[model samples]
Target: MTQADDLADEERRLRQLRLVVDITAQILAEDRHLTLCEALRLIEAARTTAGRLFPGRQDTFDLVVRPRLERIVLERFGIVSTAPVN
Candidate 1:
């Protein structure tokens, strides 16, 4: 693939990741019926989807994306802590 093609593909993957994260956040925030276990499962599913989309970028997802979802989960559930959640 040419450089432009590679750039386009990366951009597409980025958009997919963003969509996944946004949807997960929306669910975690708005779904009052969601339990803690369900929220954790959603986060895990998002991580798996992100891994499939970005291959070897798990660390990037954990560092950048996971925290955002975690924060929403914490706020929605009315919990606060510095300890690792998962």
Candidate 2:
């Protein structure tokens, strides 16, 4: 693939990541019945989806996205240790 093709593909993947993360955040914020365990599972699913969308970018996601998600979980569910996610 050409350089432009690679860039376009990366952009598309980034958009997908954003969509997944945004939707997950919405669920976490709006789902009043969501338990802490369920919220954590949703975050894990988002992380896994992110890893599939951008291989070898776990650290990037941890730095850029995980904290936000963690904060939301903390706020919604109260104090909980952040666990390693696959």
Candidate 3:
């Protein structure tokens, strides 16, 4: 592929990654009570797409997706404290 084509592909992948992250954040913010299955499904989809778009870069998927999902799950289940102070 030409340089321009490669740049376009990269840009598109970046956009997709952003979308996935945003959606995951939205889901977590809207309903912290997401079930395990629901979280897995979302994570799996993001992982698959990320892996395909950026092969050999598992850290991108792990870093961008897994941490957020884990954080949300932990916060939702009270594994991590988010207590409010008055």
Candidate 4:
């Protein structure tokens, strides 16, 4: 659309990104004993909240945060998924 509209959208997306990062950091800090299932649930809740708060911001959060978080989870817990080790 117009330049002003584009700028507003960018600003809104940035604000949502910051919120998501802050929430994730808090969750990661507080939930040291989380199981894999619990970690997945936390990620899902973060995604849901991001979508509900910003509607079309899911893509932004997913693109920016999901991969990094996945890496952190894997590294922190030494998680390695293999196919039955057969």
**Top-lDDT candidate index:** 1
* Cα distance off (Å), candidate 1, residue 32: 1.5
Task: Record all residue pairs in model 4 with backbone atoms less than 3 Å apart, i.e. clashing.
Answer: none
lDDT of 1 at 50: 91
Order the candidates by lDDT, highest first — what do you get?
Answer: 1, 2, 3, 4
Candidate 4 lDDT, 6-60, residue by residue in tens: 8998798768767776777666646778777777777777788778767877898
Order the candidates by TM-score, highest first — what do you get? 1, 2, 3, 4
Task: Return the TM-score for each candidate structure.
Answer: 0.90, 0.87, 0.73, 0.61
Tell me the spans in candidate 3 whose CA falls farther than 4 Å from its real position: 80-86
Clashes of each: 0, 0, 0, 0
The root-mean-square deviation over C-alpha atoms between each candidate and the true structure, in angstroms, is 2.8, 4.3, 5.0, 4.7
* Candidate 2 local distance difference test against the native: 0.90
Candidate 1 vs. true structure, TM-score: 0.90
User: For model 1, which pairs clash?
Assistant: none
Q: Is candidate 2 or candidate 3 better by lDDT?
A: 2
Better of 3 and 4 by lDDT: 3
In the range 1-86, model 2's lDDT, one tens digit per residue, is 99999999999999999999999999998899999899989989999999999888888989999889888988887776667665
The candidate scoring highest on TM-score is 1
The runs of at least 3 residues in candidate 4 whose Cα sits more than 4 Å from the true structure, single-residue gaps closed, are 1-17, 81-86
Candidate 2's C-alpha runs over 4 A off are 80-86
